[model samples]
Target: MGGTVTLRRALLATTAATVLAFLPNTAQAAVSYPDPQPITGQQIIHDPTVVRLKSGGYVAYSTGGVIGARLSKDLKHWDDAGNAFAEPPSWWYEYNDTGDPWAPDISYRDGTYWLYYAVSSWGTNHSAIGVATSPSGRPGTWTDHGKVFTSEKTDTWNAIDPAIIKTDGRLWMTFGSYWTGIRMVQLDRTTGKAVQGATVHHLATRPDAPYAVEGPYIVKHGRYYYLFASYDQCCAGVNSTYKIRVGRSTSVTGPYVDSTGKPLLEGGGDLLLEGHGRYIGTGGESVFRAKGHDWLAYHYYDADDEGTPKLGLNQLHWKENGWPIAL
Candidate 1:
C-alpha cells in the first residue's frame, strides 16, 4: 500500500531477469504501455479495490485507518468519503500500534458488500486479516466481523493483501506479501472467514533472495483462471520496481503456469504491465469486469508529481492463446 518508503529499500537490487525488463538488449524486456489515464481529485490511494455499488456509484477502498475510502459517480473523477470505520477496531492494535488496516478487498454477495482488510507491522510476518460487511457498500455503514485469518511471527506466510474469488459456489481468499509469497484458503460462505477445516494453499513464490512478489489477484477468462501479482519492490515512489505479471491454470487451486511453461510456484510469469514514462512501479492491483471489459486497476507513482501514488486503470485484453495482455 502507499506509505513512506525509505530510499534504501526503494533501491533494493532486482533479480537478474527483472533487471532485463529495463534494458533494451534483453529478451524479457518490458512491453510498452500507453500512458496511464490521469486521475483527478482525491487521487492518493494504495492497494485500491474499486467496486460498483448497486445504488449506481463507485466506491474505492484502500490502505489505512477505517480502510480509507473514495467515491465516484463516473469513476473518472473521485471525492474522498473519509475512512470506512468511524472509530478504531480495538483488535487490530494487537499486531500494529495503530488500529489502521491496509490492502482492502471489496466484493458483494447475497445483497451485502464484504470488505476484507489486513492489519500488520511493516515488513513483519505478524499480521491478521479481517472483514466488515455493509448493507449498501457505502462508507460509515460497515460492521467489522473481526479476524478471518492471521499469521504470527513464526509463520512462513504473511497474511495481508487479501483478494477473493467465488468459483464453483465457494469463496476463496488469496493473501500474503513477503514471507512465503501468495497463499489461498477457502472461506465459509456464511461467515466469510476461513472454513473450519480447509487447508491453506500456496500459490506463488520466488526462490531467489529478495523474493519480493506480493499483491495476488485472480480473475477467470474463457476456460482459464489467471493469477496476477506484483513483482519486486513497491512504495518507493518512482524508484519502486513493482510491475504486474500473470500466470494461468485451468484449475484455480493448483499448478499455475506462465506463457513459457514456467510454474508460478517457482516464480514463472508473463509480463502484463511495467514502468513507462511518468508511470513508475505500476502495481498493487485489483481486477473486475465492467461494461464488457476486464479492467486492471492499480496504483502508480507519478514521476512528474514528486513520486506520489495515484490511481491507474487499464483495459485488459485476452489473446487468441488465452493469455492476458494489458492495453
Candidate 2:
C-alpha cells in the first residue's frame, strides 16, 4: 500500500449547520455508514491482511519492514505493533544484498502462523518467494524459512505476492505480479515450502491490457475460488491508474471467468473497484469477512493533496451475480 493525504473541501458555515441539523434524522434512518478510520505507524502500508487472533484481538500484517503488524479490537481503530520481521534473513541478504519486501499473506495452520512474503525490486523480474514463521502472529518473534521459489533474471515472469490456500489436505501457493502474469505452485505443508517437482502454472494474465497485471489474492467462498488482482500501474501518485479486478473459478488451477463469461486466463477480468472521490489508483486488495460483513483493505494514491499513496479500508458488498462491489 502507499501513503496519501486527502483534503476534503472544508464544510462551509451554512452547510455545516444544515448537516448537523439533519444528523439525528440521518442517524435514525435505516442505513448506517461506516466512518473512515485511518491506521497509523507507517507512512505506507500496502497489501494488508487482517486475521482474528485466537485471543479475539485482530492482527493486521502488511508490506514494509518485511511486514508490519497492527492490532485492533473493533477493527476500525488500530494500534501499531511494530515490524514483524525486522531483520532480513541471512539468505535474503546473501542473494540480493537488499530486501524489497512487497506483499505478505499470513495464515494460521498446524500450530504455527505462516507468513509468505515477496522479495524483489519493483517492476523487475528478479524476485523470490520466502516463508517465515511465528508461534503467534505477533511482532518481533518470527523465524525465516529461507526461499521457497525464485525467478531467473532471464525469465519475463516476476514472482511475488505469495498467497497460500489449503484445500483438501494440500497446500497451494499463488504468486506472480509483473513481467508475465499470475502463477501458482503446490507447496509442502510441513515445511511451508514449495514441493520439489511442482511446476508453476500460468493462472492469469493480461499482457495486452494497458499495463501489467499483478497483486494476486485469492479467497475461497462457497464453491468458487475468487481470484482478485490489481490492474495497471500503482504508486504513480495522481497519474497512477491502478484498479482492482476479479474472476472466479470452480477449480483452483483455473480457467477463471468474470460475470460476463470472459476467462481470466484469456485476459478477462470484471472491474471490482477504481478511483473515486479524493482516492486515485485503488488496488492491491486483501479481503476479510468480519462482523458478518465483507471488508476490503487495499492501498490507493490520495489525490487531494500532493498525491501520496496510502492504505484504504472499505466495506465490500456482493452483487446478486456473485461479484464484489466496494463501497
Candidate 3:
C-alpha cells in the first residue's frame, strides 16, 4: 500500500492503460473521472478507511502517526482527531522498529468497533496484520488485540493492507501487496483472526512482475462480490502513479473478472479512478455505506499542495449493469 518515489517506476502504466482502453463501450464513451468533493481542514491522510459511528459522526484511520485519525461530523469539513493509539502495543515492534502501523480497516458490529491494520517495514514481505477493538470508534479508545495474520520473508504473499468483509455468517479478510496481489482467508468471528486450517484463496494479481497491486477492499453489490484494489506505485508525492480498479464475481471467494470477462488474476480490472488534474495518484481506497448511499474513501497526492497526501471522498453510484462509478 506504500512505496518510495523510486518504486513509482514499477510495472503498471501499460497495465492500467490496457484496462482502461478495454473499458465497456458505455463507460469508455463517457469516461471522465470525477473530482473528489471539496472539504476543509486537516485533509492530509493516506490509505484511509472510514466508518460511521453509531455514537455519531464518522472516524477515519489511515497510515501514519500510530494509525492517524480524522473526524467529520457531516462528511464535509474534517478535523484532525489525533492518533488512534496513544502508544503502539509491544507486539508491533516485532514487525517494525517504530511500531508504526498502516492501512487500517474499521468496522462496527455487535455493539463494538473492530479495527484491523498492518505493521511492516517498507520494501519487505515480513509483515503482520493486527486487530483492535474500540468501544466508541474514536481515537484513544482502542484495545490492541495483537496479530490476526502475518507473513514472513519465506511467504510469497505480503500480508499488509487488510480489509474485512462478512458474508453469509462468515467473516473473511482480504489482504496482500506487491508480492502476489490480493488474497483472502476466513476469519473466526470470535477471535477476529484466521480460522484454523483456513485456505488462503487467491483473489487478484497481475500478470507482470512486482505485481504492483495492493490495498484491496471488497463489497457485495446485487448478486456479485466487487473487489476494489489500488494498483501501481504509491506514497511518492506528486510522482505517484497510483490508481483504483475493480472486478466482480458471483462468489465471495472469486476468480473475479472485469466487465470484459477477464480474470483479475491475469491483470484484468475495470478502471475506476486515477490521478486527474490536481488530484494525483488517486488510490488506497475503502468503501462504506452511510445515509442510504455508498461512498468511496481514499487518499490522493495533491499536486496543488506540494504533493501532500490528502483525503478524497466521492459518492459511489452503481450503473444498471452493476459496475460502480465514483461521482
Provide the TM-score for each candidate, comma-separated.
0.90, 0.83, 0.92
Count of clashes, each model: 0, 7, 0
Record all residue pairs in model 1 with backbone atoms less than 3 Å apart, i.e. clashing: none
Strongest candidate by TM-score: 3
Please give, for residues 1-327, the per-residue lDDT of candidate 2 as tens digits: 132233231233224334434432212123222222456544356678777777788788887665777888877567878887777776665335576577888889998988888887755677888888988778788888888888877975777888888987889998888666888999999998989989778878875743378888888877888899988888788998888888999988887887668888778887767777677888877877677877788877777767876768776655444555554
Ranking by TM-score: 3, 1, 2
Query: Local distance difference test, per candidate?
Result: 0.84, 0.75, 0.90
Candidate rank order under lDDT: 3, 1, 2
Q: Give the TM-score of candidate 3.
A: 0.92
Off by over 4 Å in 2: 1-44, 209-211
- Those runs of model 1 whose alpha carbons end farther than 4 Å from true positions after fitting are 1-31
Clashing pairs in 3: none
Question: Against the hidden true structure, what lDDT does model 1 obtain?
Answer: 0.84
For candidate 2, the lDDT comes to 0.75
